[model samples]
Target chain A: MRLPSLIREVWANLLKKPATVKYPFEKLPLSKTYRGKHELMRDRCVGCGLCAKICPAFAITMRSVYGKVSPEVDLAKCIFCYQCEDVCPRGAIKRGKEYELASWSRNEMIVR
Target chain B: MEALRKAEENFVVLKAFNDLVLDVVSKDLCTKCGMCVSSCQVHAISMTDEGPKSVGPCRQCEACYYGCPRSPATSEELLKASLSSEKKDDILGSYNKIVSARTVLSEVKSVAQDGGVVTTLLIYALEEGLIDGGIVASKSTIEAWKPVPKVALSINDVLEAAGTKYSNCPSLVALKDALYGYDLSKVCVVGVPCQVTAARNVKVQPKAARKIGDKIAFIIGLFCMESFPHVKLAQFLTSNGIDIAKVSKFDIKEGKFRVYMGDAEVLSVPIRNLKDYANRFCETCRDLTSWYADVSVGAIGSGRDWSTVIVRSDEGAKLFDGAVQNGYLEVKDIESDGIESLRKIAKRKASKN
Candidate 1:
């Protein structure tokens, strides 16, 4: 309502650093607990298929990799809930902070 | 004697898995007892929710066909092999003694369905070196109240598997795991009547079941009127406004299907109303008392918190006496009225089915 208060507020905001970063150049730091891409530890996996069974989006499918059964996640369909990591009896599945998942081909969206 | 001769003649013709599919499975006479799957030496068969299916090439060994309970090729022979006795009753089958018994253990009684006799005997057998492991139906970790056949090796595992699951569980399928996976020389099997018949058939088949059957130390059969399909039973319970996961126990008593949650009755429906959910193949089953089992136990013809046990074989009588002498169980003679009621129910099931 007052012109002096408005001018003071604008001056203070001008002195403060910007809250955003440039696109594709400077990126914001991700939190340590951020959930993004899935990483499966092949050696630790027991092939129980519990992750595939508990996946609400049906994104995980069990496939034989290197003669041992493991989960292949379809990142395109994943909800990034980290439920697979939670339900795995062996701590095999982990969530990584790699949110830039845009790809030219759909086949690239799968995480083996 | 004539029927036994006929069964032998039938056994002379080797039947394969395809014959089982054609005669029992396709005709809806398969009890889903998992005998064929367990009897397959080559591991060609796997159990599905629909029934047993061939996952690998058939070896044509005829194990699956002859081992099936529905196949008439081995029924009479299996009965004679398991209970070679002269005295037999039309309703109760051949038994050494019929008694009313209850377990004295408080831990087992708290979680058991009726008298905890099954769990008590299993504990006794495991601790007494009679059996290294027992195959029982334990609750599934992923589903509520769904029975999954398991190999319980320890007393804790046996205690965890206590209580009755009113769903069709292919319990004999776990026999392979109990023998091979757990590497147990002596194992016990607990199952329903159809499963008992399957086990007996497995025991009598000399070629395929010789290794597996020899490891089976005892069989405990529970009286089953009929087992409900899991999906349909869950649907029925959900439709009745009961949360499936919250249910702690299920019981069929006094003509009612009761559901309980921690000492509180949550739902009660007439058993007749659940006819639609009963397994279609159960109606063709005639052995209500598991006539081929070593020991048969049921809630019928017994008071509250008690089980009516029928010791069918000499081994069964020995096991019963051992449990009683070890102070794990309390025994009393079943009343004549109790026997009459049990016979009436058994006859009704035999005639109605």
Candidate 2:
């Protein structure tokens, strides 16, 4: 409540480091258990539909590529719940430490 | 000396207590998906219409964060377009045993709506002290899929959250709520594919672990078809002069709308009216059947009262075994062909990919 004391507190905060981190470069140190952007381990992923199955939002769909593989995620509908990663027994799906997911186009958000 | 010994024991207890508290603070893994908003049995955890605000207690049932798949991770390998066939074959071949409704019924029945499978299982876990609480989906309305995540404890509370909601319910937002609002340390959750995916997404975030990690102990997944949009549904019902609010018991029988008001057939509308209400977010979906649910249940390949279930984890299998042993459910081997039919449908749906 004291003006002088408040001024001292403000001055003390000014001397401290900025709370914001410069993203995409000096990334913030994520905790050991941080769940972030999704990373697909091509080899381990059997495409069993576990991620899609576990997804509560149905944002992930299995798109058949003829005789190839099926499974595609619509980033627009994604809620990033990470149930997919936990259900992936093969460890195919894992969360990464990248949170900058903005994109100018919807197409850019879709991950193969 | 006796007093000193007692003090030492007290110190140990205090240190352990402090450690537990620190661990809770250090493991916050909230993904902000909003599933908690729909899971509350008491109609708690509502969104502020702007961002997320508040409504109720964190029943300490870790349904939201645990069910979330988007913690702080990178891309999911399942999202790739090249891993489908082999994965399907593996699931088929590895299908020696499955998690059945009968197995999960006892503990989940009274607590669950309809079949009481999921809710019962969660309750059993809590009763056995396997978990403190759970995150579950509660129906916000009969016509819409607007589910809110709720923290549940008692069986009655969980059962209140029963019934299928056909709209986009974000259970992950409850993860944030569990972290910032409630002091819950452990929880289990139930969610659909997208909400689960969000859990995975949040796993990789920097502060997610400290804010919402280690708090989730189990994830209960629900089998889902595509959900519908809200506005489109309102229009469809309005066109038919069906008072959306007064309407009770919305069901799809033979792909047709079967409306009932307290056991009385009020009106029946073509499924097409509802089909148009299907969320566009669904068509692009890859898994018509859930392959990732620790235990997934749905009516895709079975009768309405019967749910086709898939148990994918050891914990799920354990719960299934417990459910069966407890006499909450009953099951027998039908035929692998039922599962095969599901695969074919999935294939056909995937073929559009």
Candidate 3:
């Protein structure tokens, strides 16, 4: 393109709002059924280990806690699959829309 | 594998691979000590995400079954092998001598659990050529508070493996690792009550135990009340927000589970709270002082920094006397009254089960 046309394009663009959202301040709206992280209801969980069995990535391990087997999820391996939520008979774990999950240490991703 | 081939000349094998699966894996009785997996010459066993799995076309090898601490035939065989024809089974099994002993070597004392008797004896055995090496429990790197059976080849290795692991260690499984991996002709091994019983069963049935027959020279058993699996221990720690990696030592004293990080006390909780973390096999177990072991050792009814060592067999007596005579260990007669306290503790564990 010509220099004059480039100058006109830059000038016209200066009048518009910034395209990227300020993620820390202004959050974007998430879909209603968007699957992100798992939220466990400790009271509802019977530690039956069905979620661990259905996990395709083998991301979940059943740990024995207080005489019952409990689910421990590694968020790093989770492909945002909602199969755990679908398979859970007790509804102990459900997919929630909180996609901002990032970590410096992989250990922080484990939800026991 | 060659031994099994030689044994094939004698008799037909029955219920070898299936027995291990049915008796241990299915019942959740198998301790993930990796013994059965290591003992499998044909590579018939593997530890899976679920637990120890015996994948097929099995050679019908009975090593996995015999090496299992929770196997069905072990108890009856342990009775015959450990006890003589006349001596009846008791809560505190056969013993030639009982004493409170400690390592005279300061190096041994520095890292020793209790009196460091197990470490001291192993060091003596290695130096004197009584055994080629020793097998003891070491912590698993993947998870804290979990134990793996390790073959300690030097004094440094034995000292490093000192202290109670507070979890199930299939230490007898490493007997195979010691012979094959390290190429030791004879070795001593340390284990808990259930594992001692497995070792004794091996001593009785040479055909089933295979090359394990003459490989194990001595057995040092710990007085176990109960032990937990790795998951349960991790869970218990998580509930208290206590990090397992930071723990340096663990001891059961005066009805408490004491955890130490260096000199500082990390956590001290009642033994009752840990019952839930305990394995199901421990619930039915009757042995407390390792009735079947050649020598059983514990801190019960002994002074601080002393171990209550019960020499149960002539082999045990030989080791104890030799270690004492060599000035590696100092011994004092365990008080007659102290014997009563030990008996009471043993009976409590039996009744609880």
Candidate 4:
């Protein structure tokens, strides 16, 4: 209601940075502890299939990969709880910060 | 109408599912043998991991209460009805003959825990039309080393279910399904001592067992010192630095619990060390060899790769002799030393429990 005080408030607001960012064009940095996609170290995997056994979502399947059995994750069904990371005896499965996982086809969502 | 009212007033009050829960399940004496479930005429009882729970209204029929093996009212009568006084041994019960036997079949031997006598005898019984199916404890597909009661219809099914599971399996629960769901009129049941006692109780009980008891062709009992709770056993093994999934076989011999992965021995611990994992109900069990089973087969009092077979009933003797004569199993007399050891062990279990 005060003209000079209102003008000063407007000037201060104009100098402040916007709270929201353009997500697609200018993305914010992801936290270091973010859990998203899985990265399985094929050599470290013992072919035990413990990850598949402990997976509550039933997303991990044991499959023969390059002559050794390994876990193949279906990202479409996975809850990304990182249980595979926790239960891996050999430290084979790692959580990655790659959350942009939308795809046109379900088959493409699987991560071997 | 006056007579009917008088009769109704004089009706005797018999114990029902509630009494079973209060007397046995509540007291933690319930062995989870599935006898009560199968004994229920109205399908009121359902077997759970904890024990049998009432899923339907109780009709006060007293079938479940009387037919339960752990019931105090029926145990004495059941023993009197099922066991004979002709050749009763203090520890081994009444038996016509005892011998060390091994299966002649290579297929059975490959997978058998001991001499493959149970599998071979079941196969012979199946081929001879003695039984339409055999109730066995088969390994659960989803969980490694977990036993699930299964009705094996053929030799392959019997062989597939070979070997011993060191955990308690409520095998009698599958009796109703074997009699009705599989349409098996005559089925052989293989179980541990408590389960054998439950099966015998179901057969001897006057009222509730009439529906499913006659269908049981034979009962093959396994000698058990004690059985471990599956979850506790798994935790014990895991805590001992043994991977449950990688364990291919488990055995208790010379007072040591052994775990095997393929052909190699992975871990060994004294049986006393795993006492904490043993089912509490097993502490009350006195039978070392199934005293009431038609035939009891166990690894005790026998050489390597041989099973000690004790034939109790005439039917069991006929089956064992037939298996031997038909070249399904090879039999030899058990040594005096072996008998002495068996008696000693059985006596210890009886007195300790």
For residues B230-253, write the lDDT of model 3, one tens digit per residue: 778877887888788888788888
Give Cα distance to truth, residue B319, candidate 3, Å.
Answer: 1.1
Kindly give the stretch of ten consecutive residues in candidate 1 chain B with the minimal lDDT sum: B205-214
Q: Per-residue lDDT for B130 in model 4?
A: 94
TM-scores for the candidates: 0.72, 0.54, 0.69, 0.73
Q: Model 1: what TM-score for its first chain?
A: 0.92
lDDT of 2 by residue, B1-353 (tens): 99999777645221121232233213432223453343322233455423234455333323332223432222445322211222234322122254335434444443333455666677677777777667776666554445666767666667777766655555655654554456566667677765554443333322122123345665566655556655566666678777667655666554466666666877787655665677655555555554444566655555445556666556667776677687656665535666766666567556543
lDDT of 4: 0.84
For candidate 3, give the lDDT of residue B232: 82
For candidate 1, what is the DockQ? Answer: 0.01
Q: What DockQ class does candidate 2 belong to?
A: incorrect
Residue B56, candidate 3: C-alpha displacement in angstroms: 5.3
Best by lDDT: 4
Instruction: List where candidate 2 sits over 4 angstroms from the true fold.
Output: A1-112, B1-74, B78-96, B103-114, B141-146, B200-213, B253-257, B264-275
* lDDT (Cα, 0-100) at B23 in candidate 4: 95
Which lDDT value does model 4 have at B74? 68
Relative to the unseen true structure, what is the C-alpha lDDT of residue B277 in candidate 3, on a scale of 0 to 100?
87
